[model samples]
Target: MEFMMFCRMLVEISFYYSFAGAAAAHFGGGETVLPALLLSVCYILCELLEKHVTAPSAERLQKAGRGESGGAGRFFRYLGLLPAVFWLLLPGMAPADRICFLFPFAYLAAVIWRKDFTLSRYRQTDVFSTFWKAYGIFALTLTIFGGSALLETTVPAALVTVAGSVLLLRALRHGSEVWRHRDYQLRSLFETGLLIAAAWALSRDAVLELLKTVAAAVWNRLLVPVLTVVIVAFSVVFTWLFQLLRYLLTLGHREPQDIGEILQYFTGQGEALTETVVVSDDGSPVWQIVFFVIGILALVILAAVFFRWLLMRAPGEEHAAEQVEKIDHMPPPEDRKAGGIFRNTPAHRIREHYRSYLRCFERQGGTRLPSDTSRELARKTLELAKGTQEGEETLNMHLGRMREIYLRARYRQEVREEDPAEMKRQTSAVKKFLRSRPG
Candidate 1:
């Protein structure tokens, strides 16, 4: 779970930082980009360290009956967010900027308190709600700051990043089902494309005008409380519809991009597609083409060397052998029969019964190997009989019969005649045998 959370944090930080860096670069009044980037990096490192080291150390201290674990852990989590607070509350920032930063920070504290800092709680929270709330905070921040025209441009872009991040997190979580199976991933692409297309449709100028109108209305104090409620309500409705569109687009109904205008609107690449011809006195595109070719070749060569070096230094024979050995020596997982105990399939029902029998045996201090067959497991029961020789023989006979029936039923897929009476009899015998065993 810690490993999974670490991966999630990495993905979250990467997406968030990329967008934040881009937004800062575009609207930072020519401020250096390094501070924002470094702050993000530092926060990520602190989170990773806390999860990997500090939290586990606290757990060990608690297990050892130490009283300082709680205090130590609280201090760590509090310290971890200091970098974010520092960045958000930097000198000269607006009140709204501080609020925007503090809002998520407050949300984090609430989550930690409510969920006891369980990593999965954060992951399981509604991403759509979280995104828009964060978005609303940023919108308010921009309104309060009123420093840059580029600030409004960031709204749609931030929304796009939110969409992508949420989609990516979902994909990564259920990657085996959604990504390994190509159809779902492809669906995600179309969904993402549709989302970006919608953002493009809400052109920058229009969004700016809307924000300005909202800001003006609020400043004029015209039905201020009612306006706030209406704006929040509208934002919710819009986000829900937008999310619904994303959900529906994944149905593989390829929309018609037939008309040139529709294609242009969807792609929104009209400005990007136009090439600027550099007209110099040289009157030649040849030199320009030569420079581009040289640059491409240089990049390719550098990339090849870097990748080759990376591949060569990758985990080698000893590391791989150690990993294999660890896997081989790992204990069997606990029998979690509840998931399939009431499954509707016959196979699952039979497997659940078998697992229950195994659990009984395991509780009696019996160990089963991965390679052990049903016959071997049954034979092992012969050594458990503590009564007279005749009783041992009788127990072995019952166990042998049970094993035979189980093997045929479990392995023979074509066999449809699994007698419930026989299964119940065998289960009872197994339970009786387990109960007879010495602890």
Candidate 2:
């Protein structure tokens, strides 16, 4: 979870820094390193404090209701925006530049606290919302700063923007699926892939240049020398064989000439012989036109094939309906009880109650399949109980509430104090239905 938060932070920083840097450059200002660094530190600290300190504290204060004024919390929270004043106080800067510098800090504070006035834990969906907001800022910055050099500026920024967008999309897709299925292994693998892709995207030019240099070095220092030696050896052997053949041909005739003299004679002849060929072009070349047409036809065929494949690959309405039907019929596996002695924690008690609820359905001969998720199990069970004496809506409500608690207990790092009681209430409702149902 911490790693996931870190990845989100990285995505935020990449877009924010690019936008801030571009703006600073456009204004002919100095480096934005200080502001960027401060932004990163503040973001991390805010996330940590919210998750660990502020959120839990607020939850306690609300439950206790010790006459604590929520307004005081709000006042202190706005104090987080106080750092922007430091930029305003710095000397040797014009009013415009100071205001410009102040915007990033103020914007950073606003983005940090925008969703809830009080510091609250961010959800996975919140990450996407924050990303789009940051992307909007980047787009606006580029539009304002990239007036004349828009093409040149946009080229590099587009690469980064596209890469960040792809990361967020992949995370959002996989994160939701993994959470639903409790697929931690798949999540880890996805995180690894995202990290690799991000590293490659950021350092693609350096990596390519390094590869090119290594190839050149190998050609110059290793392959070239080896090839040279092999060529030299082959030539020497060839020359010796040629002299030997000449001597054999001579037989009893005048003594065969030395290899050196033979080589000199050939060298002189080679230097003396010279020839040149002249060709003239007439009008247009028919072969060029023929090849061009062939190339165009090949391209057209490839494009057609690609589009056909894309059309075939897309999921249709019928396919989506089939998937839904499959889920409806999917068998859910029996709930696995927690191993070892149970702790008296809210999270543990929630899990225990959820298991008991599942067992109530299991007694009715509805078994769980390993592939079925908690929600899928609940849905399938709901369908099974549709013909029973209890109303479908009531059972669905009970199952939905229990499922929510089970998921939080199973996956969430922290469970609220009220979760165990909620789980017990839902489980009792389910058990009551089971007891009243016709055998």
Q: Compared with the true structure, what per-residue lDDT tens digits does model 2 show for residues 1-439?
A: 3333334434444444444444434445433334433443455555555455554566678789754436554344444344545545777764434534554455556545542211112222333344456556656765677553322222233344345445444544443346345576467557646654544444345654565699899999999999999999999999899877888867857456664587899888877674334466664779778877796466446434422322232223333323321211111111222223312334556778888877887887677888989888888787666667768898988888888778866775346646778889989988777666665
Residue 408 in candidate 2, Cα distance off native in Å:
28
**Tens digit of per-residue lDDT, candidate 1, span 212-297:** 89989877787777878999999999989966765666455734333445667756665555444444578579987897779646
Off by over 4 Å in 2: 1-23, 30-41, 67-101, 116-158, 175-439
RMSD per prediction, one decimal?
26.5, 22.1
Q: How many residue pairs in model 2 have overlapping backbones? A: 5
Per-model TM values vs. the true structure: 0.29, 0.31
Give the Å error, residue 169, model 2: 1.6
